[model samples]
Target: MAICTHHPTMKQSRTNGGRKKEDTRSNAIRQSSGISNHLFEALRALRYPDRARLLWVDRFCFNQDNTEIDLMFSIYSKATSVIIWLGKENPVTKTAFEVMDSLAYIICRERNGAGMKGDNISPFAMKERPSDCSLFLNGQDFFCFSFSRKGPKMYRLPRHGSLGDDAIFRFNDDRLWTEIDGILSNSYLERAWIVEEVAAAAEVNVFRGKSNMPWSVFWAAYLGRQIFAFKPHMASDPDASYGAI
Candidate 1:
């Protein structure tokens, strides 16, 4: 009789484990894509040469819960420098830059005025300290995005030379501020004053579209006490071309 050797049989691995891992990876990708939609489109418009390396973009850095430590740290790190879009759709980047530059120049001049001068001041020193100012002061170069209106809108004010109490719409509107103060605290009022002073100087009105309350009420009740107003005309049209101011 011929000697027969029994061979051991090899078992096949299960497909279920690999399938589950793949499913999990797909779900993670889907979640990440969803979060990216919430990021402000204007900030995205300014092309960052090394965006992939910069951390703080909500989509890549933040977790679904938004309370994650990594996301918080990334946001804190990049909080100082921010890109404010002029509009929600088709922002005029060049125009916005020019406006900001002009405002910077104006600030420099104002700081060097006699009132701001001190014994320690130098003739060649840069006069303006925008960081010290509490208002936007950049004129009507910014657009506020309204979630309810589903669009962005520009805030406009009268010309720079226009002066006098009547030149501003809210010069006599002390009642509005009183009502606003009732709703918001004193600390909030102080902060709003700084923003308001800047807005007033620019002659621009602030608007928050798509809120339950009317623009007047919204301004007086919330934004008004804070010294901001609502201007419906600033709404942005996505189809229009963005031009330099």
Candidate 2:
């Protein structure tokens, strides 16, 4: 259960057998406050079906009247991990994350090897077979480590003024590019506080429904998208394809 303040009356009780009935008592204190339906949906989506989860909500935990802006940075910095809620998942989210997972996995692997420096920073590398896999963020399979468990095939990104033939073939699908656009165009990324929160976070996990990916991976994929757009090949229709984000 989430530990929150602002409510009063901390009633305590004990069972006859000498065991405390913690579940029987209300976990959070009762108070009257207007909660947005969007926030409610986020809280519901984060709940664990089999067990309780300890969550810290800024609105509930922070004393807005007395709290300083610096406190938010400190809290996020010290927290175990930051969860970035991107709202309920849909077909667009699923497709976007699938592409991101593959690209980020490639970036991770490269970082461990020769490192992402020089021209190698681009994700235009190849493997045995293309990863035609999909991750369904349904039920209890919402783990961030799932991508590391099985290696997904990586697609190529534009590099050195051109998208190589192999990369061009892989990126033939306009639908795939559309999904990538969807991720960047999400309104959640435009929040004013996100910059400080993410900058202060020790670890960041982005969530869209049950689907999740590391901030490093997501950022890398985003950078790749930017690089891909400005390639010489895309210069012909720059205005039509690339819009300022």
Candidate 3:
């Protein structure tokens, strides 16, 4: 697995005499396994009853040499899974994960139950989706079939005439958008390097603390919100080719 996380660092004390410390951030991760950040904490929390989880975190795994730097994209792309760390944990983030879990259940059930209309997003169809994909509110798979015996909570998805419990209709409404955006506008998403990281991954997870959501569900809802809320004049056809969306 590949972990994409925000590395928060602090300046260490000056040495007895000479020059300032170079590569403190890298040093921190190496010396402490990112104890100062959430990456190690989140990884440590990943547990399974049966076997061990192998991970390839950028901070500790990479040598920080030219060869490793050059292969950054390669490492990310080749990884079987990608875990995105948003931040620590909070009540608002918990609710977000609940909503995300519900969405995943709704989408999966909708796809399984003989056919629904809007945005036929079938995440259970793992043949089409990488099984390594996942998302977290606080950072656990709320719907991992193999890991968790308890299934995901199915929330009502937004329909054309009906609204769901989610923030689908709130994109245009700055007031409602802020509620969700406030929690999501953390350090991770604001980075300039995350574009390639997110786009290249066949499977990805959005994590906060312990709550989680499937990336597919999040993406589908995101597109739905964008098409409907951002531009009223744009085509909202369910069957229309959104191209990658």
CA lDDT of each candidate?
Answer: 0.28, 0.48, 0.43
lDDT of 1 at 120: 27
Best by TM-score: 2
- Write the residue-wise lDDT of candidate 1 on 185-215 in tens digits: 3232244223422222212222111112212
Per-prediction TM-score to the true structure, in the order listed: 0.28, 0.52, 0.46
Pairs of colliding residues, candidate 2: none
lDDT of 3 at 53: 43
| Superposed model 1: Cα runs more than 4 Å off | 1-32, 38-52, 58-60, 63-91, 114-245
lDDT by residue (tens digit), candidate 3, 15-95? 121114323543565366433344444554443334444555655555654465666666556555566654455544555
Q: After superposing candidate 3, which stretches have Cα over 4 Å from the reference?
A: 1-34, 63-67, 100-179, 220-245
lDDT string, candidate 2, 164-184, tens digits = 323432465555555466555
Query: Candidate 2 at 74: error in angstroms?
Result: 1.5
lDDT of 3: 0.43
Model 1 Cα RMSD, Å?
Answer: 21.2
Query: Which of the numbered candidates is closest to the native, going by highest lDDT?
Result: 2
